[model samples]
Target: MHRRDFLTFSGLGVAGLMLPHARLVAAEELLAPADVARQKLLADTVLAAAHKAGASYCDVRIGRYLNQAIVTREDRVENVVNSESAGVGIRVIVNGAWGFAAAHRTTPEGLATAVGNAVAIARANSKIQSRPVQLAPQKGVGEVSWRTPLKRNAMAVPVKDKVELLLSVNAAAINAGADFINSQLFLVNEQKYFASSDGSWIDQDVHRIWLPFTATAIDKASGKFRTRAGLSAPMGMGYEFLDADPSGRYELPGGVVGYGRSYDPVADAIAAAKQAREKIKAPSVKPGKYDLVLDPSNLFLTIHENVGHPLELDRVLGYEANYAGTSFATLDKRESGFRWGSDIVNFFADKTQPGSLGAVGYDDEGVKTKQWDLVRDGILVNYMATRDEVHLLGEDASHGCSYADSWSSVQFQRMANVSLAPGRAPLTPHEMVKDVENGIYILGRGSYSIDQQRYNAQFGGQLYYQIKDGKIAGMVEDAAYQIRTPEFWNACSAICDERDFRLGGSFFDGKGQPSQVSAVSHGAATTRFNGINIINTARSLG
Candidate 1:
């Protein structure tokens, strides 16, 4: 039973078996457009005051965001929520130390007070520091504003309609033989404004949507069970994302070769559910060294854990020691010839890719975004850096990766839209699989673990299929792949062509002190790697 055949025979193709009934609720009622002018005024006033109040450097950031989430469990709708948040933060340098303060109020008086507090704090902190904080030089930038394009504003959709869509998906999952189904949909619209002492003013707006579906199958007679989960690739788009209905104006792409739009929640639900059923009866895998084929869905996590997190200059320099662990790959290793992967592996950290969740026109520090290499032909080339850190590294400029999860938090070096370049030659996913005589095809991401230093890691997946004699056998259960950083990328033998590449990401990527959640994207094509270690998760658990 090949992967495709398994999906087809398991009735995962059903359209709307468990579709939610809440799709009809009104969404616009929950959201009101925020005053962009007011936000801009708050930023400008705060920055001007900070500079006049004996501050050598100062910047102000304002943020407004709206989020709506819906979760469904089997036949019951578990959670439906809508929230709006807005705030402003001021950062100032007084006597050569950085200080920051924030307030939810954006009123003129409120912003003035925030700026005053920031300068006072900076003055206080400067007295205790041994050395003055120095920031890399940056040319002044004029005012700018950016907004992601979207067919429909997520807030315009009715809440009932959103719930109904989720319910419909749940129903379809149950119809596909799922003993239980858990589904969640998230939508966020964020607006940001920034003003700096360097004369840089920037405003940005982004809308994102994500759908996660999980299904569990149980052999009622034996109490045996398996679970499968699928997460949609997040995009800086809008409510049009949810328009993936087969019967509607949108149609899901067939043959899996082309990126297709799916308006049908039922289709996604059924597919997720069917995978769960097959996993329940699948044979447990045996641990060994084997060739592995990684789908884009699964490969994205590898890039995130290996390249994304580790390449953050802060993490590499131990600035993240209190939160996310530090990286073994340090600035010293970022020379031209350091081996980070195979010669065939080329990766980059780009903040300009269209539709990337991490894409931004300007960073929190008011620097323009740009593309740079993280791994060039498998060599360590670059680490994401902030304006302040660039000076420490003796670099002329920052890579524009600095970001803060919210207005209340200070900006720091964060992950970029890191991605692996696809092979120049065109190779279909099927063609790549045909070349593998004996291997395992892994799809989607699951549980994962990595050492504190990011030297060793293991990751599981939602679905695994055994390949024998150049064909997919059946599903496999309790499977995981493990590797050390250098050894893992060195084992890469081939990668699929660009046509098979896809983007995937997470919205709740945790980082920073006091804990903040940032969203980022990882893009990669289907790839085939040579001998790697595989584990039997069930046995390891026992």
Candidate 2:
């Protein structure tokens, strides 16, 4: 695809196709600390200024965001860029309406001007408001701090080492006979401080890492092309996350490698190269219903799209419609106790789970993070909510789902670490497969499409294997499964135990009118579903 084609994706607000539009700073410059005490003083000034400007409630966020990106193709480095940005955003509720303002300057005079603008905007918005803003009561927890435990900060890792790692990963693929390969690494750190008129002062240091690799194979004689992506999940960890654990490995039936908390990029690249070529000679899937075995790697994405997004209170309430359309999981369904999955299916939203993208001590709104159930015994239990939105849900507490990608963006409702609980009964993917008559085993994430309402969807996977008489037969290609949200979950037959549980996530989950990208993780064990519809993606009907 051309650069123009990639640019057509409008879901991201600040991104560069090849290089970002951020201020390029020296490596040492990234170490410059935006002191917490200085940020507190700025926050205090903004909070006071907003209150003095006739605001009933106010909260301010001071942020310093940093990113390091390295890209490589084949055997050479393509680009290595380091960028930094800092700013402040203020939110205020005045006369029953909400308004927000932000500024790059952190001076007292700049904050005063921004606060005045925010309050004035809120007052003007009140005239056309449907209802007065009502926030769930929250007692302030004075001063507190939290950090993502790290053995080595990813940003601190020498750029030379990072580049060498990428080059070696490329060599593994090319030497294995892959025609082409592209690899990239992304590191993020957010230094943030939050202060509210309610007397809460919170400071947090967050770190995240993602290493994405893809290898391509071309059968020039037959004019065929196939590609495979590495089975590495983006994580909320430090540079240590790249260290592969010898014991944490899964031996799939087709000789595919399944990774755990620790990863081996070079090993994955070698396997990915062989898999890409194998796909060139794979058989096309026959369109029909068959029992399905989904690895955690593949199941995580299924849970993310089918279960997570639909349960957001903002989407259910139609407050967010321009992005993915409103959800089919409405408020009335929650009141009626709608059945979401099978008797054994359990779904929940969490923000306190260690190493999860959404795991934070306190949300952008200053609410302490915790775990909550979204589904229990297959029934819809609750939806994710923020501080101001909690009152509408007939609840008195927030779910700590509020977040903003940048300091200049206003915080809003975002998805948490939505996950499927492991099965209570001891079950393994191997044992569960012995009970199946005919099935397809899938691995890795692929192209997917769902209705704007997040129902009636199609999902594909990176690899497919035919299961015959409770045994792995051969590989298949161009396979996609279709589902009506409710029916798919109700078909749940079995799930592996905690030992098989793993997490998969997206670095760019877009939501809202002026789209904002957020990081989120979804976890599940090897799961089985009975009698599902399948389609051959290679077939084109005129």
Residue lDDT tens for model 2, 318-428 = 887876788999999989999998998999899987787777899999999999999999999899999889888889988999999888888999999999999999987
Best by TM-score: 2
* Tens-digit lDDT string for candidate 1 (1-542): 12332232123421111111112223563466556677666767887788789999998888765667776777777666665566887899999999999987767777888988999999999999899988888887887787777788877777788788888888888998888887777777777888888887788887777776778889899998888775457776777766764432211111121122333456766777777777778899978887898887788888998878888888888889877788889777875467988998988988888777888888889888999887888888778888888776678898898888777788877888999999888876677777877788888787898988888999988788887776777778899999898889988888878656678876667688776667788888888888888999999989
Would you give me the overall lDDT of model 1? 0.77
Measured over all alpha carbons after superposition, the RMSD of each candidate to the real structure, in angstroms, is: 6.6, 2.5
TM-score of 2: 0.96
**Model 1 compared with the native: what TM-score?**
0.91
lDDT of 2 at 475: 89
Clashes of 1: 35
